[model samples]
Target chain A: MALTRDGPRSLGEAATGGTLRLAGYLLLGVMLMMFDHRNGWLPRLRGAAAMLVQPAWRLAATPGRLVEDARRQLASAAYLRRENARLRDNLLLANVRIARMQALVRQNRQLKRLLDAVQSLQMQGQLARVMDIDLDPFRRRMVINRGARQGVHVGQPVVDAHGVMGQVTEVLPDTAVVLLVTDPSSALPVVDARSGVRTLAYGAGRGDLLDLPDLPVTADVRVGDELLSSGLGGRFPAGFPVGRITALKPDASGSYLRAVARPLAHLDRSDHVLLLRDLAEPFGPPAPAPAAGPPAALLGPAAAGSAAHPAPALRHGAGA
Target chain B: MMRLDGQRVLFYLSLALAVLLLLLPLPAALRPLRPWWPALVLVYWVLEAPGRVGLATAFLTGLAADLLAGTLLGDQALRLTVVVFLALRFRARLRFFPMTQQALALLLLLANDALLRWLIRVVSGVPLPPPLAWAAPLAGAALWPFVFLLLDALRARLRLREP
Candidate 1:
């Protein structure tokens, strides 16, 4: 009976077809998986496919927009009036801050000129719009509207108004994915602005908090210490405000303290972000090079004065 | 009997529309409860025309779904193929069952899909919430009767013949 059933009866033939189809599907699945994992050809294919899907996405988003409009219409007139007044007050506060920032910029320019800066590094960046958030909650990834076509490249530092946000990880033709600093995978070298104590800050995956590891238990770090990019890691330019120490707790296991810092950037609120270009290099050991200049010429007066100011010690004490 | 060519085209078009619906930007609050529209449509087609809608077709549709959702490839394909295969294998018995019983079966099928998805996510180092994720199956089951009635009416109106 088994042999007869297995023989090429009409039903057996159909079953064989089913088996063949499954085999084909399995083969296709393996090929697709390999291509996607390798990411060489798949990204280009995905970009092309994205263009095809764009129209469908636009149509689907229409309903969401309509719903938003309807809700706004249903809102009470009194609520709109209150919102308007609140916006006006916020605008006034923002105007004051802008004026102060402009003055500070002018002062910094004059000071730099007086210091006789030689070959100053000037980086310019473009503003990009946030396209989508990661579907998986565990991944702190976001897609931006700008992509390779818009000069966005992988590893470019992205920032919001306040401070460093993250870096671009994947670049497509029309979109790029940014891994936010709040992601557990992200790490940045930061320094205390006042004291110049350099430390590495790692994201704890909490929305706005970063953790500084390996601080001495007796370290003079305190709450409210302003943290800025150390520029030790060439990924980010020096002096960009990163975060501020918000809490400190001594660990019982060792002589180290666990410090939590809140990011200066408003990760949830910012709609536009700047992708900084023209950073020297990323955090890596310096390459060996031939000495071409005198020690005094290499270590200029500005460098000597900066080293003389025990800013790191002062910052540690103030933070503590 | 309904003409197979026109019906096939209509089926594919509806499948496309269902996929688009799945891609729509739903409100955060409602997103969790968003119906697995593509899965439901796939199941309907598989059950109604098993000859045309087979494991391979199910897998391809699932692949499309994975691509649209930005999930790991083959994840949805595996689930969808399993679901369609089971439905096709039991179509004779399933078609005889009452709508409520059929709904219960659908609930079980959807639960299986969700369970597989959750396991895959866990294996991929993602955190999984508790059993509340199974709520979609219950919702899908409740919706089964209305979906069946609507699709059945359309089939009857079009004089569709079972494959």
Candidate 2:
């Protein structure tokens, strides 16, 4: 339809048309905003819209990727050698750590057996590259290259080398949006490493700081204390480093202490992140290791107890 | 009847470039300084070719912007409709003004757009935008003169007849 009549129109007619059009759009905007707020009805539409803009996002990132590739290709041999040496040293150190970890794993298994607890599956993480960063100042989010096709689902925890980055919030067919922990709306359950006191940490909407708004005034939360995921909600796996307490001050009301934390993840610079996924259950301890087998003697007192209580062990192991 | 003109290609190309700029990431410190590129382009067309860029065009552009920036749907739609409406209402005066004066008008238009957007966002449960949301209007207005000249040059170079 023509925005205005074809013939020359009076100023009054033009003004009335403009007012009517503005009212119509404003009404549409309010309706949409209300619908989205009340029902979150636009995500499917948002996903389709994201698909339309996906190519633009990729095209926008190509120049930066090209520059990075060129830089890598043009790196000096000496610099590359130094980098390789550093990586080798890191690997050596990591292997040494793994050696220690093996003993710890053995001890953990023995302890679990003593307690008659079931074995936990090895957690796996998938790698994804950051495709685009959200430009909204109020919301700290980014789009990653993984999505439903890659088995990425909403609420999967994402982490970088340093610590917990955030969780996937929205997934498309080919890409997903991650809500960083620094966004005002993001909250995660964390436990103090020193005291094991669990508290919910929230994003303060400011970079480099997370808010713990519910800490009691008498709580023993000290600055520099490391916080790890407590896994209370089952959304994020337990024991991932989240952040460290950076500041604490009494609330203006004097009933609670307001605290701040510095997340360990490089929220701004990291181009890659890890998406944690739960592994499928393994067979139940090999069916009690075939009771009559010769190896049954190696079952130990704990295993015998577990075998006697096969009902509990099987249930716990299967649930995990 | 309108024929396919070389200037239509130039128009769409510039609009695409503006979209690219809108999507381009900036350093953290400078991110808040990004101008409203799509709005600027929209306002330019609303002024120079009012018949081509109207309320419907502005609405679609705003929707595209919302998806591109990952904001709530129709947030930019509302703001852009207001911008285009105001531009169209005053296109006669705005087109006659010197580029510098037109920039001033653009500053008001963009500031109004940002304020309206911020209001809608907050009302719709988004966290209150930081002070830098206001700073964007200044940036948008500052780029107006350059954008105006560049698009003008493109149009003149294409030698497309104005309606």
Candidate 3:
């Protein structure tokens, strides 16, 4: 009776109900948007929701996993034979390289220790696995499986086998997000490996390119020149390959040249990255003091000048 | 009347099935081709059970999808709200249209949703690919008849009827 006989009355009620529902939905949307945008509420909620859905994701992923396993099984025999042959060839070559590299590494380590005593101290690092790519593809970011629980902190430099990948921007309980060098907001100080001329590389917002701006027309740069992190800004470690200059063209304004580089790290394919815990220092050892005081004859003039230029001595003392 | 209510229930169940299908671990290449399953499901439900499935239902379903897709919160909610409102407003005429015409209308509706989503992403400073992203709507439109038929079979099996 409630279903059949009351159709017209129910229809009238439904119209009013629909209007109320629309208003309610709009209010709910506004509330959720505000919560997500302003407060740090959504990440916790999202993490909890992700936990709840983990079982579902596992369930959904099972069939695909099984299919993959089956395919691998079917291909196992021939695949193993080919893989074994390749490994054998690589093993022979690697044996020779490893023997030479071992001596080189020992010498390098001794040199590094001597340098470390004179230079900045080295800090520990942790390895993390990339769990997910950013849902918003426009921004270049990856969420790593490691978080604060694993000692991952915001601002840690994330690197991969190829080079500097990015830095940890956000740390959650079980995950952290790395903002890649390809992200539009990212900038890194780099030097031309050939000429040692330092410049800033800015992300072009496009995933594939980094742009170097304000380079003078006479700047000694060319296509194929490797760029290394200069460690000038203290944000990244020195000597890590950042990118290779791939294109250079004079700007229409002609005052400067437009240059683009392809980042060395494979932004999309990397699954594991290292987070360097140590922060690099901004300024290196202060300019060495004048070897000795000015020559004796010049001393009088220098002493008179020193009294007038007390600021330089003050700066020198501050630097020490 | 009892039959019509049963049909409505069948519609909701079909939607749940569609959501499950959408969650299936599609190959990386096929992932983008995965049409807006929830959108199509909501469209079907709103066409059949406008009273039971209205703007609120659409908004809530969209919220669930946003969570599942890991997109910014309330994005799908806003899109679904607009979509369900349009579907409800046009339900009477939609029901009278032939399957081909209905599919065309669905295409237009999906295109509108895609445009709104693109606009929201742009406003939020997310760069989107060009008009090529609307490929999802074209695929969804092509699948509309198959989706309708599949739901019709399920409803018949469940002994559901129309009002």
Can you list the residue pairs that collide in candidate 3?
none
Off by over 4 Å in 1: A1-20, A38-41, A69-81, A110-140, A157-165, A182-320, B1-6, B27-35, B122-150, B153-163
How displaced is residue B162 in candidate 3, in Å? Answer: 16
Which interface RMSD values do the candidates have, in the order shown? 7.9, 4.3, 5.0
Worst 10 residues of 1 chain A by lDDT: A1-10
When 1 and 2 are scored with lDDT, the better candidate is: 2
For model 2, residues A1-320, the per-residue Cα lDDT tens digits are 22232224444655778899889988897788788778776677777676676677787777767777898999999999999999999999999999999999899889989999774636899999997444465678888889899999998889998899999988887888899998889999899999898899998875657999999888888999999988776777778899999899998899999889999999988989999898323332334433332232455565765576565555555655
DockQ of each: 0.23, 0.39, 0.25
lDDT of 2 by residue, B38-98 (tens): 8898888877666577687888777777777777878887888889889888877898999
In model 3, state the lDDT of residue A281: 61
List lDDT for all candidates, in order. 0.71, 0.80, 0.72
TM-score of chain A of 2: 0.80
| Of 1 and 3, the candidate ranking higher by DockQ | 3
lDDT of 1 by residue, A1-320 (tens): 21232223243444556666666776676566556655555445556688754455455556755776798999999999999999999999999998998898778778879998532346888998765333333346666778889898888999987999989987777777787777676898988887777888988764447989878776678899999988776878877889999988887787888889998987766668999988844445656543323343355676556554345434544655
Highest lDDT model number = 2
TM-score (all chains, Cα) for each model: 0.69, 0.86, 0.71
Candidate 2 docking band? acceptable
